[model samples]
Target: MASNDPDREEEAAAAGEDEDTGAQVAPIVTLSEVAVTTGEEEEDALLDLKAKLYRFDKEGNQWKERGTGSVKLLKHRETGKVRLLMRQVKTLKICANHLVLPSVKIQEHAGNDKSCVWHASDFADGELKEEMFCIRFGSVENCKKFMETVEGIAESSEKNEEKESKDASDAAGLLDKLSVHESKTEKAPEEVPAAAVKADDETEK
Candidate 1:
């Protein structure tokens, strides 16, 4: 025989409610926030622009569509090394090898001023070569914006590299100067004996 106590039934129901509340999940994270975080962690991009990628056909002397992609100007947070990332839309493929912001150059087409050419070296062939890529904007203003953004990133990257090189050179120069000073200090006693001998000879004369 079991006694069905009202208080006991209420207590069991309350425990079940408590368990359900405890199992309730936290709110889901948004995709945009995740993307921003990933971008910051991976590249710390200075410039990110959407553009249609084209490869210049040397034989036909015309530009062909590679895909629509985003060009990102990124810098290594630790090394300060600049790199360009061409990431295709709806694809996991990314072109990031031997990419330098300084190597990126933009120019207007000879026949059509509205059409712009974005050129950069693709060293995936393991050789020194220039690979041309064209990006056309809907309006002249958009074209200018793209050009200015790329150019600005390139110029800033060049300056940063130059400054780093100069700093390294200066540090090397300082080390060399310190080494020379140490060597001179170590030889000072040898020179003193020579000077003393010369003084003694002069005194005897």
Candidate 2:
């Protein structure tokens, strides 16, 4: 009976170990990696700063808050085009998106040193619309930096456009000259002599 008791105790210990098993189970679903793309992939970020933006609602007759997020100036790598983009902080939703054109005006908002106002043809809503926007920065320096960078990009864009126009005009003029020279140098088709034509006609008759 004493030997049987020891064997029973050993059996209970083995069952306790099996009940508290530490095994890892495999997951039922396997996930594959997917590539994510943002439209700004082809563009290089020039400036990134945190700011709060507002837009004037003509219908409401008051200023409406657009978003508080990181505003960016993105320049295209190939085309040298610059655009201003701002997204909401929490939701990461775009609030403002427009090109930095020379014709658009950016000025200090009222007497605020940390804020600036600008007019743009915004496309954040997936359509172009004229919008008046004012952005306030946490510091005066950031406000100035954003304004200066925008102005510089605008001037550069204008110059690039002018240079492209001049280059296209020069190319067109060169093509026209080539066409005229070709016309002048081309030989006229050979005409049969009157005597030869008359002899052929007489032989046919």
How many residue pairs collide in each prediction? 0, 0
Angstrom error at residue 104, model 1 = 2.8
Off by over 4 Å in 2: 1-34, 201-205
Judging by TM-score against the true structure, name the best candidate: 2
For all predicted structures, in order, the TM-scores are 0.59, 0.81
lDDT of each: 0.70, 0.94
Instruction: Give the Cα RMSD of candidate 2.
Output: 7.2
Model 2 accuracy (lDDT, Cα)? 0.94
Please, what are the lDDT tens digits per residue for candidate 1 over residues 33-61? Answer: 34323443745876676766677889999
Residue 13 in candidate 2, Cα distance off native in Å: 23
Clashing residue pairs, candidate 2?
A: none
